[model samples]
Structures are given as structure tokens and as C-alpha cells.
Target chain A: MSIQIWTFILVGITFAIYLSIAWMSRVRDTRGFYVAGGGVPALANGMATAADWMSAASFISMAGLISFMGYTGCVYLMGWTGGYVLLALLLAPYLRKFGKFTVPDFVGDRYYSDGARVVALVCAIFASLTYVAGQMRGVGIVFSRFLEVDVNTGVIIGMIIVFIYAGLGGMKGITWTQVAQYCVLILAFLIPAVAISIKITGHFIPQIGFGGVISEGANAGRYLLDTLNAISADLGFDQYTQAFGPNSKSMLDVAAITLALMVGTAGLPHVIIRFYTVPSVKAARLSAGYALLFIAILYTTAPSVAVFARYNMIDTLNNVAYEQAPSWFKNWEKTGLIAWVDKNGDGKMEYRAGKAIEGKPKLTGQTGIYGQALVSNKVVDSNANELYVDRDIMVLANPEIADLPAWVIALVAAGGLAAALSTASGLLLVIASSISHDLYYRIINRSASEKQRLLLGRIMIGVAVCAAGYFGINPPGFVAQVVAFAFGLAASSFFPILVLGIFWKRASKEGAITGMVLGIGFTMLYIIQTKFLGVGNWFFGISPEGIGTVGMILNFAATVLVSLVTKAPPQDIQDMVESIRTPRGAGLATDH
Target chain B: MENQDRLKEYWRRNLRLMLVLLAIWAVVSYGFSIVFVQALNKIHLGGFPLGFWFAQQGSIYTFVGLIFVYVWRMRRLDREYDVHE
Candidate 1:
């Protein structure tokens, strides 16, 4: 069977499963919609959180990016996972004890100000919407690549599927579907990884395969990482096993990026909200641990897959004739993700160091003399590096690159859609509830009844889905530019305030407002200056990507300093913090 | 007043435990993984350099363990303070 047909069947089956789960778990009341009635089991909540946290980026792009980044990839691997430690210890339990519906709810009530809530609501919306747009774009790309549909059609299909389950079931529906998604994506990711691992190193466990010696070919008896290093060095590229390789980011910058991502993960409103669905503080704690465990299943495997995929691509494609290039090469070439410019016009493809084209390949809908796609971009004046591979293709084309079955390739398509849709729904709920629960119900219509609130929440979900889909289809160029900064903004604005609100009794609304404004404000200024305006890195050589670390530090310092000068929070609010400190008497999340 | 004293003590104990655990977390990730990585990489863990393993793989597993340990210790602390729910 063709990969396309198999994709249709697998994707069709997965869609059916998600829609059915949504139907069965359909929610009507606002509590059910917002926090799944606060009765979810810890293990299931863990699974849901994993699905919610692992977006299209995690499934489709991380390994690809890591493959090229080599040992420097630890920034993402550790940065993303370490945040759960902060979440489990410093955030989740207290937030659960406080029993709030949104991060804004906790912020507003704890700070004793509606103004603080509004600020938090805006930040939550800004960050979640930016992240959701990327997920929708990912959905569209996956559909276009696998289902053979146009990108916009694929996006519409994705939006419709999301509307069915997400609009119908809300959090209740979304949670169950995410459990199913976590299963599909993990299996899809693992099966190919395990298969390729055995083929290359005779090891079934990818973590073991990571260091396992190559079992075949001339490189047999060599460690996989060692083999990759030799090949990369031979190509005038940095060794894969070495840190701070010639092309790698500075260690200080890598540490800063990792710290930003770590705190940013903990502060994300969508991820934190998942803890509220569990029944107790204990459940919240357990669920967080389980969440990390489930996420680690994929996170640990990714580096190994990076090693195998990197080794295979270079080994097969280098010095091969263009016409006789591997089938995966030709297939991915048509998609315009991997281009061969044949700079020397020798009819041979050379995979070496340096850029082949001046910039990204622009297809003119023309074929070259060797029947390869003609790139309109100018060939760079450098070495015989004739290939340009998109980072996204590393995971997407892995099955084909390793000659896995058509079914496995189709399974990957299903898995990619599951990842994108689950994250989109989770982020949509945050945007919807931020507007409906926080803005409309709390501020605009305090006298509104349950039915009105529920209706507004559902309507807001519809609006958010459309908004996300629109941005997905016509992503403002800044959508991509601003996406990385979502974490920075979250780290700078949200993390400090939330932490201070819980741990420090004297933290005031004035202090939180000041902290958020100064922290996020400075971070944004630095990013716009360096990233957009091309200002030189003025802060100790830290790029905009790592400036969030500085922003986070400034937030903590400013919040504390402002609090010291300001009046202490009332004794009642201090007592509230004391109560949130313990695990006893936690209950269902409430708006009040 | 007596109940208040107990709550304060429980909170104090919790803070101390958290401090100890977060310290380990920082040492493994920031200490061994980043700051002292060059020194640690000289030591090998089978096929992996120790620092690289800590940075990428080991830190994640330790994070999971830390959360569970917090859960277990906090559970006992809850019982000790008669605050178990």
C-alpha cells in the first residue's frame, strides 16, 4: 500500500477515536468545561499533560534541530524537562491547593486586585495564542506532506477536527483525547526509533543504542556517537560528540537559553492548568512526576534518534549520484524541504560543510539537468556542500530514510497530527478561558449565571479556534519571529510573579505589576533591539534567545525590591498563602 | 496559638526540605552539567562523558525522582503536623 493510502486510513482511525472520546465526555457546565470537573485520575492527568506539553515542535522538529546542533542540543533536552521539577515543587501543589480556574485567577485574587488579573490575562492570551499559531501551522504542514492536500485545506481540516472535539467536550473532551494522543505519538515515535536502532546497532532500546557500537558496515565495532563524530569531522563539520564545537553556541549562552526555557515551561498557563484538573494536591504532585516520566519517554529517545538519523543521512547521501540518490532524498526533494543545487554541476551530490545556497531554497517549479528541483537561490562561494535539508524533515522523513514500512510512515503522519491537535486544543482552552472565565464572567458580568458563563466559554472556544486557524493559514511574518520569545515573555512576566505570590506573603499587587512590567518590558526591548533591529549584543554577548535569563533575574529582583518598599499584603492574604502552602483541604477549582 | 505554632513548624520543615532538594537539582544541572562540565567530561560513564550524560539524560531522570521524593517527604510532613487531608 502507498504511504498516502496508509496515512488516510491511520489518520482517519485516529480522528474517529478522538471525536468519539469527545462525544462520550461532552461537557455542559463551566466547571466541567474548564477543569474536567476536577476529578481526573493522576495517571490519566499525567498522560493528558504530556500530550498537551509535547507540541508539533517536540514531535516533528526537536530531533531534527538537535541532530544538527550535536552535543549543544542538551540546552533543549534539559531545559524543557527540568522545568517540571520547578513546577512540581514550587508551583503545582500550591496552585492546586488555591483551587483556581486560571493563572490569572490566582494572580488577581492573591494580589487582591482586578488590575493584576487583567495583566495576567493579557500575558496568558499573548503567549498561548503565539504558541497555538505554530501548532496550527504544524498541523497544516503535516497534512500537506502526508495527506497530499494543499496546506490551507490541511489547516481547515485540522480546524474542523479540533472544533468537533474541543468545542464539544472542552477540557473534559480534550483530556481524554490527549490520553489517546500521547499513546499514538509515543508509539509512532518509538517504533521507528527502535527499528532503526536495532538495524544500526543491534540494540532495541534507543538510550542504549545511543552509545552502542555500530553492528554493521565498515564502521561496525565503533560507538554510534564516535562514528558520527568521525564522519562529521571528515566533512569539515564539528564532531557530533563534542561540546562547544566550532559552530556551537557559547556555553554561557546555552546555559542561559536552557534556564529561560526551563522557567518558561513552568510558567506556561496551559501546562499549569492541567494540574488543576486532578482531584487533590497529592494527585497534582503525583501527576507532575508522572508527566515528567511520560515526557521523558520521548525526550530520552530523541537524542538517540538524532545520532542514528545524522549518521545515516551522511553515510548514504554523500558522494552519491543525483539520479541514484536515496529514495528518501527524491521524495523529500519534491516537498522542497531538502534541496540539491549540484554547485559543481558534476551530477553528484556532496554532503559537506558550508552553505550550498546563499539562503533558503526557492523553487521556481523548474527541474535541473539532473532532474532535481531547480533552486533559484544563488550558490554560495564555499565547499562542495550541495545539500540543504530542512530541520523538520529529520523526524518526518526518518521512516523513509531508514526504509521502514509504509505503515510506519503513515503512523508517523497520524502521530504528528495527534501532537499538533492536542497542543492546539490545550492552548485554545487557555485563550478561551482567559477571555470567558477571566474577562467576561469575572469582570464584565459578575452577575451572570452558570448557563451564561458556560455559553460564553463555548462561544469563546469557537472564536479562539477561528483566530488560531486564521493565524495558522496567514501567519504574520512576526508570528514565527515572536514564537521563540513566548517563553522569554512567560519567563520574565509570569514566573516571578506567580512564585512570589505563593512563597512570599508580603508580595503586593503593586510589586507584581511592577515586576511583570519591568521584567517582560526589558526582555521585549532587548529582543526587538537585537533580533529585529539587528543591534549588537550589548548584554555580555547574550543573544535575544538567552536574554530571558537576564529578564527573569530582573523580575525576581524588582518584585522583591518593590515589595520591600511597599505596604505588606493584608494579614488575610498572608493567611491565604499559609493555607496554600499545605496539602490539606484542597478542593475543586473555583472562580471565586 | 498552639495550632498556629504547629503550622509554622510544618512550613519551616517544608522549606528546609525544599531548599535541600533544589540545591541538589542545581548542582546536577547547573553545577555538573554546565559550570563544571569541562572538568566532569574528563570522567567517562561507559560510552558517554559524565558531564554530557548529566546535561542531557541524567538530569531529567533525577528531576522525576526529586518530585516523587518531595511527594513522599511532604506526605510524612503532613502527617507529622496533623495536617493530613
Candidate 2:
């Protein structure tokens, strides 16, 4: 069969698997709808969580970001995984003990206020929309490339698949389906990478290959690190080992970004909801550990892909002329993802560093100074000056660049779709829960029956998926930039409230409300100004990246100061705090 | 009631172990990798910069280690709590 035909069959098989799973696990009660009947095994839940968490960003964009950023890309590698540790240690078990179906449910009950729940609901929606945008786009990209369809058509098809399973099966279906997706996406990611690594480094293991000595260097036994750094510097970029800018800001930026991602990942409603699918507090904790282990498999290998792609890229075009650039180069150039300008009207291209120093005025972003334009204007002489590489194309292009089989390329397409669809489905689940559980069942119709609540949840999932699909078409900006806003909202709102509720006996409802309002309010204002209004240049000296860090500080201060001013949490609430922290009664936590 | 007390105590021990592991987590990612990366990069590990390894490989190994520790300890804790499956 043709590659396209086979790819279609693969997608059909996966979709059928999802639908059948959802069909078999149809909701019999509200409990099954919201928390998957609370019966998922710890290991299965872990795998599902990994699938839900990895998303399009992890599957498609991350390895690409690392490919060019070299060592700097390690920030994402460390930050994302470290955040899971924070989730497992600080958040998951207690939240599980709270025995809620949604993130807003926890916030509402723990703070003993509906207003706090509303704030949490709003934050969850905001973060979910921003995140879902990327996943929808990821779905579109995979469809556009392999399925020979427009992004919008792809999104519609993706939305249908999500609606069929996610809306019908609820948490139960999503949980098991995510496990299947985890297998598909991981095998898809690893097979090509392992093949490429062995071919290039002559080492069978990717991790060891990344560390092994360069085979043909002047220093034949030179370490991979030294060789790569020299190559990066030769290309006019900073050495892979060298630090950028002043020490203080770099430290602050790294800390701020890492903290934002950590707290944000832990606080995200979609991720938090996964914990609810487990049977007990201990199961929640174990699921988190499993999720981290599953995630680590991808995180560890992503760096290897990055290093390998960079080396392969540099070697391919090192001395080749613009006219002789490969077919992939020309194809990518048409997409504006990889551009080569013939500065000075020269027929050839020059890949040297000092060339960019001559022509253009450097752009000063609202934040600190961007490094000198990485691209030089000089036409590369037979040597391509600098490749204008877009970060989004990295993961998609890696397999093709490695000369992997066409079936492998098709599998990568399936993997990317799986990653996108899995996260999108998870986010849609959160959106549904917040509406059906927190808003409808809790406030709007407290007396509603299980069937009504389940119906509402399904309707909400469809609406959320459609809204997200619209935004995916006209993405607000780069995938990372848009997702950072989600991080900021998460850092500011959910993290502070959840932490204080669990750890501090003195924390009050008034304080929790104040913290969430100010935290989310400040973060929203900053993101709106910087990304939408273009007002970042006027007020703060820095960009939107640093706003979450500031907002987190504000959240903490507001929560503390208000708690001191207001009445302490009631004795009962304080007792609840003690119980969640104590971790006793792991199996006996009540639905009440 | 005594089973509840044992379960609570089991939880307390689990929390204690997490705190220690988390401290190591902070030191590796924030302390060595981000805050003092340049200084550590000045030192070498197997010809690779120490900070680079910490950022790319070292922190991940620590994460995996923390997970196994948590799982092993928690299983025993479950047994102590009389909640073992």
C-alpha cells in the first residue's frame, strides 16, 4: 500500500481504538463521568498523565528548540521535569485527599468560598484555552502535511475525534486512551532517533553517543561537548558552554522561567485532574511518580535528538553553495521557516559571523537586549551565511533529515497527532469539569441529576473544542510565547492558593480570594499589555516573560498580608489542612 | 482508630522522605544548573562541562532516582499504614 494510504489506516486504527475504549467505558453515573469511576491503576494513570502532559509542544516543538539552542535548550529539559517532582511532592497527594473532580473543586472547598472557586475556574479556562490553541495547531500541522488536508479541516476532524471519545467517555475513557497514545507517541519518537544516533555516532545508545568522542576531529578523541562548542562558535554563535549576558539577570531569568514552569505545571487543571482518576491518595502519589518516569524517557532522549540534528545540519551545509542546497532546504525555504538572503547581490552565500555586523540595526525588545542578530546579512559564498531556521520545524524535519524510511516519517506524523490530540482531549476534560462540576452542579443546579450533569459535561467539551480550534488557526504568536502566558496565569493564581491551603493553617478564605484575584488580575494585565496591547515597552523594563515571577511574589505577599488582617481559617478548615498534610487514611478518603 | 494513626504516621514518613529528595531537586536545578552554571562549567566531568550535564542529563537522573525512592518508600509506608493492596 502507498504511504498515504497506510498513514490513513494507522490513524483510523488509533481512532477506532479510542472510540471502542470510550464505548466500552460509557458513563453509568456522575462519578464515572468526572473521575473515571475512580478505578484506574496507578501505572495506567501515570502513562495517561504522561500522554496528557507531553502535548504538541513536547512532541513537535521541544526537540527542535533544543536542536539550535544547544546547551541553552536544556533549560526546558530540566524545568519541565523538575516541575513534576514539585507536583508529586507538594500537590498531588493532598489534592487527591480533597477528593474533588476538578481543580476549581479543590480551590472552592479548601478555601471554603465559591468566589475562590470562580477565580480558579477562570484561571483554568484561561490556561486551558492558551494551551489548547497549540495542540489544535499541532493537529492541523500533522493533518496538513501527511493527510493532504488544510489545517482547518484537520482541526475539524480532530475535534470530532475528541468529541466522540472525550465528551462521551469522560475521565474514564481519556485515562485509558491516553495510555494507548503514550505507547504510540513514544515508539514514534524513539525509533527514528535511535536509528539516526547509531548511524551518525557509531554508538548504539543515544545517551552514550551524545557523550562519545567525535570520530573524525583533528582531536580524534575529543569529547562531543568540546567538538559541538567549537562548531557553534565557528558558526558565529556563542559557544555552547558560554553564558549569555550578565550573571544576575541570567540567574533571575532562569530561576523565574523555571519556577514559573514548575508551579505552572503543578497547578494546571488538566494535569491536576489526572490525579482525580486514581482510587486513593497513595494512588495519586504513585501515579505522579509513574508519570515522571514515563516523561523522563522522552525528556532524556530529546537532548540527544537536538545535538544530533544540529551536528547533522552544520555538516550538511558547511561548504555547500546556495545553488547546491538540498531539496529539503528549498522546500523549507518556501515555507519561510528556512530562509537564505543573497545580501550584496552575490551569487554565493557566506556562513561567517562578522557578516551580520555590517547591515542592520539591532532590535531592542521590551525585555533585556536580544543577542546580536544570529543571522548575518552577508550572502554566503558557496557557504550559506546563516540558516534562518524556525524552531517549530525541528521535530518534524528530524526524521526526514536522517534519511529514515517513509513509514517512519508517517509514524512521526501519527505521533505528532497523538501528542496534540491527547493534550487537547485532557484540556477539554478540564473545561468540561469546571463547567459541569464546579459551575453547573455546585452553583447553578445543585439538585441536578447525574444524567443532566453528564450531558452538560459533553456539551461543554464540544464548545471548548470548537473555541480552541478557532484560536489555533490564527495562533496569537509562537507556540512557546503563547503557552508562557498560561504559565503566568497558573503561577499567579492556582499555585499560591493550593500551596497555602495545604501548608498554612492560618490561611483564610479572604486571603485566598485576595491572592487569586490579584495574582490572576496582575498576570492578565501584564500579558494583555505585552502581547496584545504592545504596551510592555512603556511600563516595565522587562518583557512578559518576567511578569509571572513578579505576579507570584505579589500573590504570596497579598495572601500573607490579608491573612494577618482577616480572621484565621475556621477550626474545621484548619483541621482539614492537618488531615491533607498528615497523609493518613490513604484509602478511606470520603467523597464528601 | 489505630489503623488510622498508623496510616497518618506512614504519611508523615513519606513527607519526610519527599522533603529530603526535593531539597536535592532544588540544588541540582536551581543551585548548580541555573544559579551557578558558569562557575560549575569551569569544572569538567568526562570532558563535558559539569553544568551542561547537570542541565541536560544530571537533573533527569536525579528526577528518576527521586521517583524510585518515593515509590519504594511509599509501598512500605502503605504496608505500615495497613492500606497495602
Candidate 3:
């Protein structure tokens, strides 16, 4: 069967499963909509949290980035997983004990100020919107490539699917669907990775295979990392096994990026809200452990998959004849993701080091079946490399690259859609609830009925989904880049406030409000100045990816300084803080 | 007075345990993986440089271990404090 037909069948089946789960778990009230009625089992919530946390970036783009960036990419692996440690220890149980439905709810009540709640609401909306945009774009890419639809149409289709589940079941619907998604995505991720590992190292476990000796290649007896490093060095890239330091990324740069990612992961409202669904503080803690364990299955495998994919691409494409290239190469070429120009008219492709060549190559009179130019303008310069490959293509094309069966490739398409859809729905829920519950019900109309709140939540979901779809159709940047910005913003705005609110009894509402504004403001200024205006060098050599660390520090300082000068929170609020610290009587989530 | 002392002691014990676990977390990720990476990479662990392994795989395993340890110890702590729910 054709790949498209297989993709359609697989994708269709998965969507049907998600829709059915949504229907069965349809929510009845605001609690069901917000925190899944606080009855979710720890293990199930763990799976759902894993799905919610691992977005399109982790599923589709992380390995690709790791493949290209080498050891510098360890920042992502360590940073993302390590944050769960902070979450489990410092935050999750207490937050659960506090029994709040939303992150902003905790912030608002703990700070005892409407202004603080409003600030948190804006932060949640900003972070969630930025995040959902990336998921929407991820959905668009999967549909456009696999389902053979236009990007915008694919986004609309994805929005409709998300709307069906998220609007109907809210958190309850999204949670169950996410459990199914976790299964699909993990299987999709693992099959190709294990298959590639077995093919390369005679080991089925990717983690061990990463260090195993190559079994059958000419490099037999060479360790996988050694072989990869040797090949990458031979091709003028840095050694794959080396850490990023003065030669490439500075140590401080690595540290800063890692710290920002860790803190950002903890601060994300969507993931934090997952803790509220579990029934008890113990369950909340256990769920975080399970979440990390599930996430680690993929996180540990990603580096191995990255090494194998990079080795495969470089080995197959380096100095290969363009005319004799594999069918998969030609297929990807038609999508304009991989391009080559016979610069020397040697009719052979050279995949080597150096920047992409300047100027466009003359196109041959070749047209695809869709009546589009088969090979759009090839970018060629006087460099040795004649091919320009998009980083996003690494995971999607891995199975095809290795000549895995069509069904496996089809499963990948389904998996990608599942990953993007699950995260998009989670983020959309965060946005919807913040608007409906925080802005509409809490602030605007304290007397709004449950029915009215539910209605507003559904309507807000519709609006948020459409807005996310718009961003998908017109993406401001690459998927991972946009996600990094979201993380940075979340770290800057939310992490410090939440932490201080929980641990520091004297943390004043005025302090939180000022800290958030200044932190977000500084981070935004830096990102805009660096990313958009291109004005000055990054401060302290921190890329915008790591600027959140600086913002977080500033937030801490501002909060501390402001709180020291301001009057302390009242006696009752201090007692409330003390009560949440102990793991006693953590029942169903309720407003204080 | 007795109840207050018990609560204070419980809080103190929890903080101490957290401090110890968090210290390990910091050492593995930031210390071994970043600050002392070059020195650690000079030592080999099978096919991987020690620092590289710590950055890519070892630190994450330790983190998972740390969390489980925390959960187990905290569970016991909750019981001791008569706060388990």
C-alpha cells in the first residue's frame, strides 16, 4: 500500500480512538472541566502528565536537534528531566495539598490579591498561547507531509479534532485521550529506535546500544560513540561525544540554558495543573515520579536515536551520486526539505561541512506529480557540501531512511499527530480555563452560574484553538525555537512567584506582582532585542534560550527586595502557607 | 508545646533530607556534567567519557533515583509526624 493510504488509515484510527475516549469521558461540571474531578489514579495521571509535558518538540524535533548539535544538546535531556525533581520535591505535593484547580488560583489566593491573580492569568495565557502555537504548527507539518494536505488545511483539521475533545471533556477528556496518546507516541518512538539499534549494534535496548560496539559494519568492534565521533570529526564537525565548552558553546552558556529549561519545565502552568488532578499529596508525588519514569523512556532513547540517524544520513549521502540516490531521498527532495545542487556538475552529492552555499542553483525542468517544481532552486555555494537538509526531517524520515516497513512509517505519522494534538489540547485547556475561570468567573462575574462558566469555557476553547491554528498557518519561527521562547517566558514569569509563594510566608502580593512584571518585561526585551531587532550582543553571552535564567534571578531579587520593604502578608495567610506544607488532609481541590 | 515541638522537628528533618538530595542533584548535573566535565571526561566509563555519560544519561538516572528516594523517605517522615493522609 502507498504511504499516504497507510498514513490515512493509521491517523484515522487514532483520531477515532481519541474522539471515542472524549465522548466516554465527557465532563459535566467546572471541576470536571478544570481538574478532572480530582479522582484520577496516580499512574493514569502520570501517563497524561508525560503526554502533556512532552510536546511536539520532544517527540518530533528533540532528537533532530541533538543529532545536529552533538553534546551541546545534552542541555535539553538533563534540563527537562531534572526539573521534575524540583517539581516533585519542592512544588507538587504542597500545591496538591493547597487544593487548587489552576496555577493562577494558587497564585491569586496565596498572594491574597486580585492584581496578583490578574498578573498570573496574563502569564499563563502568554505562555500557553506561545506553546500551543508550536503544537499547532507541528500538527500542520504532520498533516501536510503525511496526509498530503495544505498546511493551513491541516491546521484547521487539527484544530477541529482538538476542539472536539477539549471543548467537550475539558481536562477530563484531555486526560484520557492523553493516556491513549502516550501509548501511541511511545510505541511510535520506540519501534524505530529499537529497530535501528538492533540493526547497528545487535542490541534491542537503545540505551545500551548507544554504548555498544558496532556489530557488522566495517567499524566493527568500535564503540558507537567512538565511531560517531570519528565520523563527525572526519566530516569537519566536532566530536559527537565531547562536551560543549570554549571551542563551541561556553560552559556558562550550557549551564544557563540547562538551568532555564529546568526551571521553565517546573513553572509551566499546564504541567503544574496535572498535579491537581491526583487525589492526594502522596499520589501527586508518586505521579511526578511516574511522569519522569515515562518521559525518561523516550529521553534516554533520544540520544541513541540521534546518533544512529546522524550516522545513517552522513554515511548514505556523503559523496553519493545524485542520480543514483535512494527513492526516499528523491521523495523528501520533492518536499523541498532536502535540496542539492551539482555545483561542480559532477552529478554527485557532497554532504560535508561548512555553511550553506550562497545563491540559487539553476533548476532542471523537473516537475512533481502535483505540478510543482520537483527540485526548487538548489542553494549552492563554493562549499564542499551540496545538500541542505532541514533538521525537522530527521525523525519523520528516519524510518523511511532505514527502509523500515510502510506500516512503521505510517505509525510514525500517527504518533506525531498524537503528540502534537495531546499537547495542543493541554495548552488550549490552560488558556481556556484561565480565560473562563480566572478572568470571566473570578474577576468579571463572581456570581456567574456553573452552566454559564461551562459555556464560557467551551467558547474560549473555540477561540483559543482558532488563534493557535492561525499561528500554525503563519508560524513566526521554527517549532523548537518558539517552544524555547515559551519556556523562557514561563520561567521568567511563573517559577519564582510560585516558589516564593509556597516557601516564603512573608512574600507580599505587591512583591509578586512587581517581580512578575519586571521579570517578564526584561526577558521580553532581551528576546525581542536579540531575536527581532538584532541590535546588540547577548548579555553575559547568554542566548535567548538561556536568558530566562537571568530573568529568574532578577525575579528572585526583586521579590525579596520588595517584600523586605513591604508589610508582610496577614496572619491568616501565613497559617494557610504553613498548613499546605504538611501532607495532611489533601482532599478534592477547592477554592480557599 | 509537645505538638509544636514535634512539628518543628518534622519540618527540620524534611528540610535536611531535601538539602541532602538536592545537593546530589546539583553535583551530578551542574558540577560533574558542566563545571568539572573536562576533568571527568579524562576518565572513561566503558565506551563513554565519564562527564559525557553524566550529562547525557547518568544525571537523569540519578534524578529519577533521587525522586524515588525522596518519596520513600518522605512517606516514612509523614508517618513519623502523624501527617500521612
Model 3 residue A127 CA deviation (Å) reads: 0.7
Models sorted by lDDT, best on top: 1, 3, 2
Q: Is candidate 2 or candidate 3 better by DockQ?
A: 3
Query: Could you give the candidate ranking by DockQ, starting with the highest?
Result: 3, 1, 2
Better of 1 and 3 by TM-score: 1
lDDT of 2 by residue, A1-592 (tens): 6657878888888888888988887786778878888888899999999999998889887988877566667668887888788788788888887776788887888888888888888789878988998888889878987788998899888988888888788888888889999999999999878877776676767777877776653545777667878887777667766654321235566676677777778888899888878888778888888998899899998988887777766666655566666666655544445554544444444454433233442222222121112233444345435445666666677767777767777888889889999999999888877777788788787888777777888889889888888887777656557777888888888888788888777888898888888987888788777787867433334456656767887898899899999998788887778777644465532334
Model 2: fraction of the reference interface contacts it also forms:
0.52
Q: Write the per-residue lDDT of candidate 1 for residues A26-113, one digit (tens) a residue.
A: 9878889999999999999999999999999999999998999887888899888999999998999999999979999999999999
CAPRI-style class, candidate 3: high
- lDDT at A564, model 1: 93
- Return the top candidate by lDDT: 1
**TM-score for chain A in each prediction:** 0.98, 0.90, 0.96
Between candidates 1 and 3, the one scoring higher on lDDT is: 1
Give every collision pair in model 2: A348-A380, A349-A380, A349-A381, A350-A379, A350-A380, A350-A381, A350-A385, A351-A385
**Candidate 1 runs further than 4 Å off:** none
Model 2, stretches more than 4 Å misplaced? A216-221, A245-249, A330-335, A344-349, A352-386, A474-480, A533-543, A582-592, B1-15, B77-85
Worst 10 residues of 3 chain A by lDDT: A367-376
